[model samples]
Target: MTSDFVDVQIANRWLTSCLSLFGRVFGEDSAHYKRLNEQFPSYPKWPNVEQAYGVLLAAIDDFEKEALFSIKQLIEAEVFDEFLDQAEQLHSSGYFQPAAVVAGSVLEDGLRKLCGQHNVTLPDRPKLDWMNSELAKVGAYNKLIQKKVTALADIRNNAAHGNWGEFTSEDVTAMIRDIRDFMCRYFA
Candidate 1:
């Protein structure tokens, strides 16, 4: 009986770990995560536990064969492109300040994703400059890119804090272009 209890505990632990991994890799909204989540038994036991284990293994195999990393990068690229489009529209409509803010947000998010991809540990609420510095330290990019990101972060901060006169519409235009290129280079 003791051995059976231990087996159940081990199985439950492995299932929980696999669920967490699937959530992180495929996203919580993904079918891979949803399928496993739906199949996991509330009170794991006997054949139910074994079945869940089989499902977990199959999901892992499927994700591995699907080349999920490239798929994830492509998905991110599309989403970032949409945000960039919105920023460009705002700039053309004489809403350059908000445009700068939006572009800056994209840059920050890109940096965060790059950090994750490069295995850089992220803080709960990572600042743009901090992420930039960490990525540079890890040789993810050179100092030049890091400095550019620093400047971009400043523009974003200025826009966010209502410093309208600090930067111009032209600056926002350049910012949008730079962020688009950066996203394409890294995310695409």
Candidate 2:
């Protein structure tokens, strides 16, 4: 009976670990995670636990075979692309200030992801300049990129604070282009 109890505890721990990892990597909304989540037993019966373990193993195998790169990175890339596309639309519609703000947001998010990928510690509410500096210190990028990010951040700040005269539509266009390139270089 003692051995059985220990086994159950171990199985539960394994299930919890697998669920956490899958949720973090593929996201909870992913089909792989959802399927395994469905297989997890509420009661922790031996057979149910075994079945869930099997499902977890199979999900890992599927993920390994299907994803050549990090799924998180791929997902981030897709999201950034969509946002950049929206920024482009905004620029086309003569809403350059909002476009700059959106493009700046994408840049900031890309920097945060890079910081995570590089294992750089971030504050609770990290600013773009701070993230950029941390990433540079960790050798994620060079001084040139850091300076470019600073300029982009300034433009973003201007747009966010209603400094319309500080930057031009052409500046916003260039900002979006630079952000797209930056994301492709890092997140892609």
Q: How many steric overlaps does candidate 2 have?
A: 0
Model 2 lDDT tens row, 21-120 = 8887778887767877775665566666656767777876876786626776787799999999999999999999999999999998888888888999
Q: Residues 118-170, candidate 1, lDDT per residue (tens digit)? A: 99999899988899999999999999988888988898999999999999999
Best by TM-score: 2
Every candidate's lDDT = 0.86, 0.86
Model 1 TM-score (2 dp): 0.69
- TM-score to native of every candidate shown: 0.69, 0.69
Cand. 2 TM to true fold? 0.69
